[model samples]
Structures are given as C-alpha cells and as structure tokens.
Target: MTHELGHAVHEYVSKKYGELGREKSCAQAETASIFAEQLVFAALLKAETDSKHRFILLAKHIEEMIAKTYRQIAFYRFEDMAHIERTNGEVSAQRLQEMFKSVMDNYLGPSVDTTGVEFICAGIHHFFEYDYYVYSYCFSCCVVNSLYEVYKSGTVANFAEKCMDMLTDSGVENYCSALAKFGIDATSPTFWQDGMRLFEQELSELETLEADIMKRTYINLEKKATH
Candidate 1:
C-alpha cells in the first residue's frame, strides 16, 4: 500500500504522469517492506496462545528491529557527516571501524555485547553504494508511525483501501499530499515522535514481563531453599 499507493499517488500527482519516479517510489517501497514485517510479527503475537512466550517474542522482535533500524540509520548519517568532513579525502579502514563502533555503542547501550559484531562494519553495502541513503530506514519508520497513528485513530475511513490504491499507483507523488489525507505532515517532528512512542511502549511491555518473571523466579527459589 505504502509503496504503490502512497508513493505512486504522490509521484503521479506531483509529476502529472509519473513515468519513472525513483526516490519516492524507492522510499515508499522500503517503508512498506518494514511495515509488512511489523504486521507479520504482530499477527504472530496475536495468534500465539502461550502467554509466557508471547511477550518474549514481542520483546525480541522489538529490540532486534529497533536496534537494526536505528543503528543502521545512525551509521549512514555518521558516514555522511564523516565524508563531508573529509571532503574528497579517502576513508580508511580504521576510520570506518571507529565510526561504526561509536554508533554501535550508542544504539546497543549497555545491554548487548558489541565485540561479536565488530566485523559487521566491513559488510555494510550502503556505506559504499549509497551516500547517506541508509538514513531512509529512519525516515521509513517515521512515515509508518504517522500512518499507523491514522490507522489507530479511525479518522481516515477506507485508509487501507487508499493504501492499496497508493501501492498500485507507485510513482513520484508528493508524500505531503499522501500523508495529508491522514492529517499528517512528514516535515514535522510529531510525525516521527508517534513512531518512537510506539517503540518505547513495546520496550515497556517487555520490561514489565521481565520483572514479573524475575519476581516469580525469586519466590520459587526461596521456597525451594526453605524446603
């Protein structure tokens, strides 16, 4: 929907014919891919009967998705800035390693071990292929955030239908118009904030479940000791 519809409409409308709109279509396509993955993850959680594993799966998926998206976007932005600072100067392997390490530390926080993934910097195709394009992952989430809010608010009737249309019409339409249907302005920070808030909500749910499990485990251990 996002790819073909939202973007296609924007490109076609913005361009009048929408022959071969590249950036808008590509961005929308990328966003739709991630959104579809999220929908599948959500469906799995809903279908699962086991309450114990549901939150665990939810937590793991949330962490993995957010970490990958945020860190990769940050890496792209960092590389862009680094290149700008260096101008036409060449990028050394050590420089790339240092930059990758800095962002990994920022995103992984104190929870995960980064040593195992140090070599990952060498494999990032975006760092070489697309200058500063990796941040589109972050932008994709921002666009999805506002769209999901519109979905949840029930303000836009036939939203899914519109999305389906947009998908089929994939082109170089103005995203502003596409999102305006839902009263969203992608230029505003509020649009992205909605997505971040959703991410945080998932984190909170995970933490609460972890706390409950730890409490129960402590009680069980104490009972065994007493016996």
Candidate 2:
C-alpha cells in the first residue's frame, strides 16, 4: 500500500513537474515508498502492546534496515571495486569473490561469518544487468531517512505540501536541490549518517526489548518449575 502511494505520488508529481530522468525518478519513487513503510511501521509499533508482536516488528525492521542500507551499500562498494579491478586486468572469479567478501564483511560486521560466502555475491544479478544500480538503494534509503527526520522534528510547517512540491518538481531539480527545500543537503558527508543513526537507534531499542522479553520468560519458567 505504501509502495503504491509512492508510485501514485510520483505520477502526480511527474504530471505537474514533468517526468524525471529514469534514475532520479526511481530514486524519488523509492524514497516515497521507503518513507511510507517507515511511517506505517512507526504507527504499528506505537499501537502494539504485545511484547511478542513488538519484538517481531522490531526484528523485521532491523532486518530491512540491514538489507536496504548496509547490504546495498556493500553491494555498491563491491561493484565499484570489481569494475576498477577489471580495468587493471582480467579479474578472476576468485579475486572477485574476495572483493565481494571484503566489502560484505565491512558492512555485516564481526558477528556475520562471511567466510566462504562467495555464493551470495553471485545472487546479485544487478552487476550483470546494469551498472552501479545498487547505489540507488543506498541513496533512496538515506534520502527518505533524512526526510523522515525533518517530518519528525516539525521544523517545516506544511511538510506534506513541501513533499508534494518535491515530488512534482520531478527531474527539473536534482535530488540535492529537491531535498534542499526540506533543509537536507544530500551531498554532505554527514547526510548518510542521519539515516544510519535511525537504524542504530532502532537496533538499540530492539536489544533492550529483547532483554526484557528474555527476563520475563525466565521468570515465568522459574515460577512454573517452583510450583
């Protein structure tokens, strides 16, 4: 539903502002969809009272964050590296795999065993289908995240109208220019961090929630055993 809204809004905006170039349009559309998902999730989280349900939502949210943000960024990095290496010489499959694993490790962190995980790199068809397409995911995620922060802060009155204006502007304005209306400078090095911080905050909340849930389960089991 949220994704559809993105498309609808994009269409509406495109009609008024003219169609954006394929890449910018995709990025804007994706930004709307991802932002919609975040809004829906936030609403659901607020209304939910059951610990189990909350935990499930948080887990799914975390998984989505990892996949959309970190994983996509890693893929982009791997693609960049692989292309650069290929220019120097013919990059062997093994060399490509090493490059993939190294980038994956940087994002996945120490907990994930990336050893012998070369097969996962093969699963991404984007490298063969299109050049540098994975970067859009990272871009969209970060842009939407920054936009969400703007909405949350209530710094901009008439936020919805501003968003509509942005969507409608289409390709007339570059992403950085479109986002500038909302006071977001997408080119800034700190811009991506704004998005990342949202994920980090959610992960911390999930950890705390999980710990509470575990404590409750232990207590219940102990009581049952004693009785």
Worst 10 residues of 1 by lDDT: 2-11
Per-residue alpha-carbon lDDT of model 2 for 110-202, expressed as tens digits? 998877877788888989887877877777888877888889899998999888878767657777888888898888889878978788888
Residue 109's lDDT within candidate 1 is 84
**Model 1, 52-123: lDDT tens per residue?**
697779777776657547776778766866787578788777776777777777776889878846468778
Distance from true position, residue 12, model 2, in Å?
4.5
Clashing pairs in 2: none
Candidate 2 weakest lDDT stretch, 10 residues: 16-25
Query: For candidate 2, what is the lDDT?
Result: 0.82
Stretches of candidate 1 above 4 Å error? 1-25, 109-118, 222-227
What TM-score would every model get versus the actual structure? 0.79, 0.85
